[model samples]
Target: MTNSPKPRARGADKRRRLMAAAAQVLHRQGVERTTIADIAQAADVPVGNVYYYFKTKDELVQAALAEHAGGLAEFTGELDKLPDPLDRLKAMVGAWVGQRETAARYGCPTGSLAVELDKRDDGGLDLEVGKVIRLLLDWVERQFRELGLPDPDDLAITFVGAYQGMSLLANALRDPEIMTREGNRLTRWLDDLPSAREDGG
Candidate 1:
């Protein structure tokens, strides 16, 4: 019985490694261009081992989606710990701007992935890729609502749109500084908000 547990534990470890590999490969090569072989090589597992865990590439994609979702939740969870709603919102913005270098290279993992998946028209998989953006939108909306904004949803949409646009520009220009500048501009705009002033009081 103890020996049986060893195999299960190893299987779980392998699966975790495979999931991490999938996310890395997907980000570097994109979903359409990435092959199971790439993922296996990244994970340092034999190519045949990929089939042992995942029956199809779509299944592996789902695994990667789960990883992204977990990352989104963890990010928001850290922000949720902050007492001030505006501070939480700023922190969220800062995170993207802080990773301006990475965005320049990879172009916002969730946004780029969504665009690629949507271009393929892979049935409902686009929705899966969209969940990350939706999570961000929902979090931003919640922060605005906590600040008692009348149009919290609209504010959320505006902020997310600007962030994504800045990311696109940063990636296209190969300049992280552009993203940082845009983030600072967003901070100034947030500060000048009438609702924010009222909420601060």
Candidate 2:
């Protein structure tokens, strides 16, 4: 009799399923409402299977946060295509606000988790959110550096802070128009900066 092909390791498959399900749950319901049982049901796995990979709900939440952060990193790659520093800054703000609007309709998995984690003190979830936010800030700084601006880090923080604040305001008010107006105003302000004007006419 021919030997049957060896089956894939069930442990690896189960972990993958759990992560995927966690991502879906966090995206749809936000981290506050996504329980272990909910994740198990979504993944079609036993509740015990979740604990096998993550000891606590917070651990699972961190994993989901990391996955969402990875997605944002991919989106940031688009900013590298622009040649102008001011233009790059504009693109970054536009992309961020546009993403917030998209998420508002379907739910912002990353932003939701960020807000949830912010309310808590020192913890794994907070650390994960901090890493994601730092990554975004670093990307902004790099864009400023590429544009030949001095103190890229500070400039990036200023620009990102403005955009983030505006995003929060727009989201809270359930208005995309506010973001659009603020984004345009930000772009105009950036264009008027000394560094931008020094680059060319």
Candidate 3:
């Protein structure tokens, strides 16, 4: 099948724009409030073209969720560069706090999406949301494992749970400083965790 020259050149670009726009709109506006038209306008694409790419709004939402999942995977990989696993864990927490203003204004992107999707009771969307959450949990757990923590899984849960709880409060209070303070506290806590070998090795 011969793809039209113009469509061929821009197909990838348009889809990329649409997916990026979908994630932005979904994060800022919530999935229920976000519409395909909203994403099209954000992407500056013709409304009809959205249908060509995504059969329905739900499909677009899934794509947007996938984009987030991909980002988390990439982020975790980058954090691996730090020599110390504990440092890696702190860096991850610092990143969340680094986006203080943005998170305060819009809330945690993946966290908010999970809440919106959960409220809708849509079929199987919870799995998509869970995947995003799991990505962070798993990465943090890996770092804990490296530190030789006896209960890396439970320790990972503590780190992520504190992060998300801080995110929620920061959003509610619209105070980026709250996250910064909590993030600093987390870094200190990580520093204080017994050496993995010392703890249980």
Candidate 4:
């Protein structure tokens, strides 16, 4: 008889499920509106079991922030595979465009969360949100640096800020096509940059 697949590690699997579910629920419902029981139900794990992994809702939200940071790392890593720096930047724009529908439905995942968390006097979680934004900014800066742009940092900020502003507009207007149009404009901006090293060596 064919051998059956091995059973997954229950403890680790539950924690992973809890973290993923926390991210999803927190994205759908803001942190102020979400609770441990909500995440437990979304994760399909017992409410008591959630405490075994995270002692409180704040801890669970922290886990979700870490999960988002991890996702950002993976995202930049994929962009690293492309040979052209401009292409990588353009691809990033394309990714935002692809998520237009989701953005319109619930706003940019990290952006909305950060805005909500920023209103609080609490310290740690706000820093975690900064880390996520930093990851994207730093990655974009590196691409501009490689392209020999004189103001890589400023360019990176502009690039990412434009996307963030567009995301806000898309959500505010409930229009997904705004992202598509802005993405195309951003791609054109990238393509119009000087092909030669701007620093003149």
Pick the lDDT winner.
Answer: 4
Q: If ranked by TM-score, best first, what sequence of candidates would result?
A: 3, 4, 1, 2
Query: Candidate 2: global Cα-lDDT?
Result: 0.74
What TM-scores do the predictions have? Answer: 0.91, 0.75, 0.93, 0.92
Residue-level lDDT for 87 in candidate 4:
89
| lDDT tens digits, residue span 13-120, model 2 | 887777778877877777777799999899899998689888988877777766767767777776667676567778876776676665444434555567777787
Q: For model 1, where is the 10-residue window of minimal lDDT?
A: 192-201
What does candidate 4's lDDT look like per residue over 1-201, in tens digits?
A: 997545457788898889999998998898999999999999899999899889989999888988888888998899899999998999989999999998887888889889998899977788888888899899999999899877999999999999999999999999999999999999999988886565475
- Model 1 C-alpha lDDT per residue in residues 103-158, reported as the tens digit of each score: 88878777888888887745777888788789889989998888887789999999
Q: Global lDDT of each model?
A: 0.87, 0.74, 0.88, 0.90
* Span of 10 residues, lowest total lDDT, candidate 2: 102-111
The digit string of per-residue lDDT tens for model 3 on 30-120 reads 8878889999999999999889899999988988988898888888889888888888888888899989998898989888888878887
| lDDT for residue 177 in candidate 3, whole number 0-100 | 94
Q: Superposing all C-alpha atoms, what RMSD in Å does each candidate have to the true structure?
A: 2.4, 3.8, 3.0, 2.3
